[model samples]
Target: MTSEDPHRLEAGHLPTPFSADEIRAATPQGRTQVVRTEPLGGAASTRRVRYVEPDAEGVIQVRTSIGEDGEDQDAPVRERVTWRDLQSHASYPADRTSLERARLEHPLGDLDCVRYTMGDGDAVDTVWFDLARPGLPVLLESRRGSDLVLRVTLLSDEVDPG
Candidate 1:
């Protein structure tokens, strides 16, 4: 899907806490993307490529794990999350701790993003949502004190199974 205005998120006003219907409408029915995690401490970096699509039951995720040697390590595993669960996860709490807008650069390219930050002090988590794809997150960052404990990035979503 193409954006009507690529810069809308940077300049225009946006509805905070996107509604479920708005997310459903904005999200593509199917997507195949790579998720990457940065290595922390002595651990190795990891990558997982998964295909997610909608079915009569709800949404299905087919994930294939990649080994540290850069090869598939296991058979694909499938899981389904019901529509009820999707909706519940999509809902925003009545009181949000913090919200902001920013531009993020990812493997998918540059995107205008809306960021939601929760928690305070040493315990904090932040999620950056691509404005073009309302429900999907482009990046998730977790920080402990002054150090970044974990970071997950959505590499790309242009890999179509068809």
Candidate 2:
């Protein structure tokens, strides 16, 4: 998080918010079961991550709308979230290394907290791990330029016990 404390990548390092187990462990504790994945994408697709979960299958690729203004207003960006079958890390690309940016204050709603970014490009994955919360993606936001197209805030969550 801090410059002094740099991110170290080692074997078996998963850059994702949390592993499948972590998400399952932090499932809703009691009768409350309102927590769930935000309905960003509703249609079925093999290339996009329509919804995300611990055992949900496949890695999610955040889609960014890329185009120039006044180019074509009729063809507005139509994005959807979908998932693919989970592939072994050995087969996964190694380019997804962590690219830590900074440790600064991230204000979600009214509460201001310290958070950091990982991965490269205009929008990196942000997590408030230090904020002391459970489950994967305490807050995972995907943005296109300054406009926030999608945001996953953990309000309440759980996996159906089988």
Candidate 3:
């Protein structure tokens, strides 16, 4: 899809305890474009931000990632991918009817799932996608303590790339 398409799903969560700047800097240029910052769900240690980028077939996803401090830990490098890849790799519970309903209602398309190790030596998995509009991306974070899920919609228009 062209970059101008406003109806794209782009959302995901970052592992806890990592630097936002580092993650942003490391994100592939143009492929994943940061949109803006968003409020955290609760007492989460990580930060959230929205983004937009083309998937494998060039479909844009309104994406987000949660970042935490990863300086001293063996956290795997933050994993990122196009929505197309995520959609292909997503695995849902066979008996979870509610989850299946949710998927059908708000499909994440390409921005599906990602797994990474947290600083506390635990694995954090995230699933994200567009629910209603391209600007509004949903994020589901599963960590050690509680499962944190957030739905963030695009709040602003495209930032002039000038």
Candidate 4:
């Protein structure tokens, strides 16, 4: 599996909310590269993390701003995660999200996907992803009432299923 496969999530992509346990269950054997970006406004900063699990190796590319000019610095950092680590973090579902829409056009303008809305009132989160292609997150928006806290958008994705 390579990141430059030009697969574009294929077709008929849909996403369902994976409970906390489900995410934990999928940690091991499901390794891929994810690229996401957060637009800057708060703290005048943006971050990007690309998780690389090559041959059971846990590597990540961390990018952050530095200095008063907000220049960016990127570095590759590896923090391996084993099956036991994931199992230790697994837990029962605390909250559930319902499917909000289907066949929705992703903001990236390439893939068709689904949306799930979770949380309540002041702490609502909306996530969209392609179940057919589970590499990078599609889009994640978290808001507390009328104020938006964080927004992460997919930049690119390549799945390396080693």
The worst-scoring run of ten residues by lDDT in candidate 3 lies at 13-22
lDDT of 2 by residue, 37-93 (tens): 332454211111112233343322222222233122233333322121111111112
Which runs in model 4 stand beyond 4 Å of their true positions? 1-53, 56-72, 82-96, 159-162
What's the lDDT for candidate 1? 0.62
Candidate 2: regions farther than 4 A off: 1-116, 130-132, 157-162
Order by lDDT, highest first: 1, 4, 2, 3
lDDT of 3 by residue, 7-51 (tens): 222222222111222223333333333332333455433333323
User: How many clashing residue pairs, candidate 3?
Assistant: 21
Taking all chains together, each candidate's TM-score versus the true structure is: 0.71, 0.34, 0.27, 0.52
Clashing residue pairs in candidate 1 are none
lDDT-better candidate, 2 vs 4: 4
Local distance difference test values of all predictions, in order = 0.62, 0.34, 0.33, 0.47
Judge candidate 3 against the unseen true structure and give its global Cα lDDT, from 0 to 1.
0.33
- Candidate number with the higher TM-score (2 or 4): 4
